[model samples]
Target chain A: MSDFMEQFAELRDQKRFQDIVDAIPYARLMGVELGEDESGELLFSLPFHERNVGNTVLPALHGGLIGGFLENAAMIHLIWNRESLDTPKIVDFSLDYLRSGRPKTLYASCEITKQGKRVAHVLIEAWQEDRSKPVAVARAHFLLATTS
Target chain B: MIATPVNPKVFEPMGQLFVSLPHCATLGFQYLGADGRKPVLKVDWREDLVGNPATGVVHGGIITSLVDTTSAVAVTAHLERFETIATLDLRIDYLKAATPGKAIYCRAECYRLASQVAFTRAVCYHDNPDDPIAHGVATFMRESSPLPMLQEPKA
Candidate 1:
């Protein structure tokens, strides 16, 4: 536990979130990035890539990637502010598709709805150009870091 | 809605269309045609698909993608025609982490088809259905999508 605590503190000193994101292959594959919003709150964004296109006619982003991005967003937020050294695991994820994901930049943010010793709940919303018109919304339960 | 008859002939071809999809192709999804009347899909393991570099376990989201894609494609089995559909909602339960270095297989069933919606259930496993890695149930809004991905392949 002390070793993991040391590692966590060392990460907090440097580019913590970005370094963690870099280690995740799918997050890298989908071009998930962490940056500050206009108000300087940490935000995750999926940058446009041609391969990310799920619907060629409408030229829309793939539903899978949209779902993946939201899941990744929640995981990253939890990792960035995790209270335990153990890594969190997703238990279940549910998503609602409000509109077609445009083939452009998509942004997502997460809120920890409830936190407990062994589990946590998170709600996420993703939008394209307009924050008011979210393209997708999701909620998930994660098994928080547990002693190995 | 095109009142097309239930034709078994389109099953294989429809599966082919899904595999050729840009996203599916990019992820290397293989459309394994109906086996014993149940359509199965597979995606081989790739280093690029690894999520936890420490353990080489694939990302949880990949399972979601597989289940969602399979559940969506499974609707054609019931309708017996390739129609534009949109995923209205999906829930994935991660039963366990998938074994690394093994391809993942999925089986999905569209049990009910209402006028405008389809209900589906899917399972993702490595070698045995009895021990699934994740289970999912997804609902698709039929005829709502305008995607041109399903242009009628000339029979």
Candidate 2:
């Protein structure tokens, strides 16, 4: 393992979590932000940006961007919930677009439905305004990185 | 209303329309013509799009976006009109991590286009079509009619 990764494993949960998020280049390009809800669950948000728009007619956010946000949320959720320092590899991803994502700030949350020795399943939901009315939802299966 | 048969000529301009989107432009997506009725798109590998810094592999999210956008283009090609369409669902299976520093190509065909829904299947590859990096299936909700009012006035 690299010295940086070893040091990451030694850091506290909060710093380690931040490092993981920071390490993903795509997440930074999309300007994805991470925070926590009142219940201590991780919350992900993508601030409104013109570069996120896919359809100029409806001015809708790109479907892929929404999917990426949910996937990133799941990844962060997995890292935050687990103790491993290795990054998870995505096995498969499925997303259902519940509604057209407007060009506005979007929020997301993830739930780990199942965690096994070698794999993990996550459900993620992304919304714009109302939490109940999600713009998109997704399920992802990830192969956990083996600890040394 | 009887469904109109879309003219193949409509694809060129429609593909241009897709690449005009800000997000698509930001990701350097290009409309790489087509194969038959299917529309093909390409995104060259770049440092900013890497997911695994250690391996320099493109993120799965970028692949998802590429497939989703290519599928949408296929739907437009099937319709032969710039009707508003929203992705209803998209499922992508990553067969392997994308080869670093190689441009990725995606092609999709709208196999079924009903009044309200369009179904598409897509594949992403790096040098050979036979060996795909990812396979995707998606469904899109098609608006019954064009909503011209929602469109930005052409500058």
Candidate 3:
């Protein structure tokens, strides 16, 4: 297995999911926190920061960061329950901005629509306050390939 | 939301202002002026932006941000007057991983503008325009709060 997978396997076995996320700088930089539902399904939350503002007029969240949140959430969902070392490669990401996200903390949840042998499609929704009124909805396709 | 740009000539200042916005500046996007008729933008590689730690490739989200922002700039450049253009949707295809230390650049064009929508396509590349790390197409809804003079007269 690759060195990354080995390290991931090691840390994943010994700690909670947040600990593993804390070990990754990318997640830390985004300031995302992980939580679970009543059923123990993972959910991602992005804390509000001043630098996250995109337009100064209505003061909305950057669309890109919202995309980043969704993308990362899907990836985290994929790896949370797996022992395989294969890191899922993002193929494509498509998102619709349903409404302008207010300057508030954002949350995302991923549902894997289809998980094939070598490819997976995940659907993600992000909202700021009300989950029913999602600010953005996205679907991503990932290539699941083993690294030597 | 953004104040309306009076004319296409303001594209330069508008592009700069777009990047100077809190989020864009935080990500280190530099407005490179226009390449012919299209608007160009740049983002330097940074450590915290690295997505795949194993390969040290920049995050795909960085490219998405670049494309989406650049596409909005393209509309600002293409329009006679600009207002709060909302990004209705954006689709990005990850073609290749960006090398860790390379500053990526983007060029985008607003291909079509209708009564209610603006269409744009963009490509992000490290060195050559033909060689892209990612390509994206997006649409912006023209939510124009037109002045009384600019509004359509009674038909």
Question: What is each predicted model's overall lDDT from 0 to 1?
Answer: 0.81, 0.83, 0.81
Q: Give a tens-digit lDDT track for model 2, residues B1-155.
A: 52332765555677877877888899999998877778889999999898777778898889999999999888877764456778899999999889999999998989999989999999999988789999999999888326641343365
Candidate 2's C-alpha runs over 4 A off are: A1-12, A16-19, A145-148, B1-5, B144-155
What docking tier does model 2 reach? Answer: medium
lDDT of 1 at A47: 81
Candidate 3: regions farther than 4 A off: A146-148, B1-6, B144-155
**TM-score of chain B as predicted in candidate 1:** 0.88
Interface RMSD of each: 2.4, 2.0, 3.5
Off by over 4 Å in 1: A1-9, B1-5, B153-155
What are the per-residue Cα lDDT tens digits for candidate 1 across A7-70? 5446655857666667778888878888767875569988888877777777788887788899
Model 2: per-residue Cα lDDT at residue A72: 79
- Tens digits of per-residue lDDT for model 3, A14-74: 6466866665566767788888877877788888887877777777788887888788888
- Find the candidate with the highest DockQ and give its number: 2
Query: Largest lDDT belongs to which candidate?
Result: 2
Model 1 lDDT tens row, B50-147:
87676688887788788878887778777656677888899999998889999999998887889999999999999988889999999999877655
